[model samples]
Target: MDTRELEGFLAQHAPFDSLDAKMLRSVATAATVITFPRGEQILDAFTDPTNAVFIILSGRVDIWNDADRLREAADESLSAGELFGFSAMLTERSVGPRAVAATPVTIARVPAAAVAPVFASRPGARFLAETLLSTRHQALAAPAYSSVEELITTAPLTVEPTTPVSEVARLMTERDSRYAVVPGPDHTFGMVTDSILRRRVLVEGLPPATPAREIMQPATATAVVGESAQEAQITLLDHGSDFLVVTDRAGELRGVVAPRDFAVSPSTAGVALNEQLRRAGTAEELDTLARQAPKMLADVLGRGLPSGRVIAVYSSIVDTIVRRAIQLTFQRHPDLSTEAFTWLALGSNGRREAVLSSDVDSAVAFVDGTPPDEITRYRAVFAEVDEMLVGAGLMSDDHGASARRTLFARTNADWRAQATRWLAAPTDGNGAMMTSLLVDGRPVHGDTGLPEVARVFSDLRRHPGTMRLLLQESLSSRARLHSMRQVLSRRNDTFDVKTYALVPVVNIGRWAALSVGSAALPTTERLRVAAGSAMLPRSQASTLIEVFETLQRLRLRYQLLQIREGIRPSDVLVLDRLSAIDRTVIAQAVREVSSIQRRMANVSNYVPTADWSSTDGL
Candidate 1:
């Protein structure tokens, strides 16, 4: 490569631009020359190929490979100002644009080892690296949250100096937290974690002979105290710690802060809902306002609340919103008050498995002999509130909603008519199917005196009834899967992810809930509430929740990653991108769902298992 050509090229990119004439010459002098024929496939998506930075001289290049082929060709053609194959030059992988000459091309190759000097000399190099690291940088919208700190919680956790590791572990367990900071003899603190036990005692074969100080992370990494939850989250992310200890002005630890504490922070969902409940005037306003439940759910999950508390906090928030929404609706349509009523929370919201952006699955009810005006009030309020939610970007379930038909109505007569028509008239043909969606509903607001509704649902379920019919509808759709527990992909390709692996768990949960008139829709809680009493084994119930949550987390993480990548967030996850561990977990989750579905099928439909795994495993 000519020294002048190298000087001109180095001067163009910022990190490189800062180089003096002498250094530029040095770079150009040391630069190796690599030439290629007019065409080449440089890298695969999953693997990196090059070990040097590529600078184009006389020829052009194309980027992409069939495997890591981000593009079939140079998705964006590079000219003199543009650097191509830089990732290959910078790192030990096949990365970046596959520099294929549009015609015969001349290029400069800078060894990977030398790239760091350019970075060290010019901070701009760091920016360039990150920019190239992500291809679709233009599409990455600013984060919705105000700051990154809003999601981390590296607050220091401290305990009394006398607290032993056993007691520390007990506190951590009771709090469902992982790490604890122990009180120090001085102002400095000692810490304890399960990792210490595993690494020191178990792995090193050492006894509990050493004090916790031998292994504790220094408190220096945690928040100083009184910082916002956002700052706490940042401290945690920066420190990779889960628990934080809040201190007072004097620097004495006052309380322990964990992910859950941050999630239920006063300024966010819990506080906002509390404030709204006081100010809300009409039921329609309340319901419309409740759309923030998803926002709160996002915040809860964003703060990295653990699974159980995440579910618990989110459920409580949704329940609060539902009640508040209904209360405001009634205020606006006072005539609905004539009859005792219940606002049933169906589907995920009912069972406490609510997530951000889930839909509204609910119906209204009144005592059997409701007056016509009450029905009008209830219907009108629901209509207004439902439309408000749609306008606010909160979706309603697909079966139907308050906007269409007479879905939100008053009276047990109305519900009875709907349920009876589905079971008896069966004209809808999708009766058992639709009923399953409705069956998991638990009253959220109004005169939640809904035992009658539960009884009616349970009776129909036990009869020559909807239980088997619902089971068949759900299972038949999932039958003929290629693997016993795996989602059967399509004949051409396998996208049977949600249909086979996820829905079955949810449907079985619905059936179980209906069988017991469970007060919840979420499979886990329904199973929990119904355990022993509903003839459900506690262990099985717990396992089912784990299965459900695993699927839910996978789906959630997939969506979050898409959002990060500037890809459209969709339920259709690209399985190839998942880690090997994640893929295995997903497969296991799917299989668990399958096993539970199989058990439910055999039990409900009296189908004899050809093999023993279904029954014996259960």
Candidate 2:
């Protein structure tokens, strides 16, 4: 490849985005361009990996493992700006061993060595590396967060502009609504609210037969169907309306955006965080906003979200809030670039299922460069903000997210090396440690490009022995599915309930997903996403998730009972307070545990050797 081509290619990756003219020229002056053809492997597991990560100049790369060629174990293709060998680079112990190639054209390899030193001196380099190290299969331009379709309150009240006022009131009452839409023949809408009923018809001395449009508010607030709920919030706030009519791209009315509905909706916390980020000027302000997250979920639950989905939604919001807070921290400290760094959220926070009183697990990710001096300064800033977040009500993780836990964060190269060692030779004792965090981790915040880090983590989990170990360790802790007699009635006397029962299912689903590289944020989600080729089918997976949810809700309800009674509750429970139906559900959940345990026993050869390698753990 020529100089012009090399510069163009490197320009497309991160770090280059924020590089000043002088730095850009410096990068251009010291880049090497390599070429590959279709089907040629650019890298593999056996290469003597270096600290430098690879950036695809162009074309597609297939990630396959001949050791286990099953569709369950391999990804068919990766495209432009997607990175490979990043895990190899990040892991200080063992380099990542994934292949790359040309779809039909040439590709380029930019050594982290050349720009790495310069990058280390620059905050942008740390940001770039952090982005890559986030999950080990880290990429160059991964999506910022897991994006999902927006849900809206689509079924709304409707009426014609010519409707009578008294009839409008009847329509509202019949539909159990306080507002209704009155659309003109041309499709323009006006709103008829409960307030209008009293003022326009009753107080104004207008006849009950007056046309609806006459009594309705003429100034209508509207939002497009795809517009974010935050936009809807602002529209309502700006127009002094309780709801905004949501229209489609073609301008047809799609639905109504109610303030209550938008505020209480699940998973759209990103919309709110995005808005907050746009207006944030300081990290302290962002920290203040994060404290409001739990209450928001508590309110959503009050609005009728099921206990399980409520936890998922609630945790999702908190993750987004904390993520934005970190982003704001980076913005405030321009000396610390997010581009070279990957931020890891740990423990309950990592899982996206935090309760109102939960702790945070987090670390800073950087790239391994020629000089150790490269990331030291950014590390100082990372230390400062890490402590700041703790003081802000996110308790420190019990598992020690503190730096005392041996530089728990590393560059893409360092992390990949460690993940490789844990995967290839994971001891029975600590096998669950690194991979546990990986399963709950969603890039709730920070560089999405680091999915490669996760890939590496998951790939290592494919080790059959680790599966056997996890299966054994987890099932040993399972509560009896059903006692010969009553179960929870004898809780502390029977099972600890919280750690012994729930954690097994949690860890089981987590290990299963890690073994297959499922990119799901929660254990329930992991089970669903991994059902395709897992030993369990979709129905079994659903049942497991259902059981897990039942257990969690039971725990939550017990807590609520304690709070209500001023009992100063613990997770231990009494089955007596539960409805007959709930008791039956718990019994069924216990039965599911039994089934999982039996299956685990078979997989583990519980009778003897307990061989965990079923098709190389795929």
lDDT of each: 0.54, 0.58
lDDT of 2 by residue, 234-276 (tens): 4454343566777787778777755334322332322343234
RMSD, one per candidate, in order? 17.7, 29.6
For 345-384, candidate 1 gives per-residue lDDT tens digits of: 7666666666544576777777778777656656667766
The TM-score, computed over Cα atoms with residue i paired to residue i, of candidate 1 is 0.47
Minimum summed lDDT over a 10-residue window in model 2 is located at: 140-149
RMSD of 2: 29.6
Residue 605 accuracy (lDDT) in model 2: 62
Sliding window of 10 residues with minimal summed lDDT for model 1: 137-146
Q: What ranges in model 2 sit over 4 Å off?
A: 1-288, 327-334, 370-380, 402-405, 460-462, 474-476, 480-497, 532-534, 537-539, 557-584, 606-618
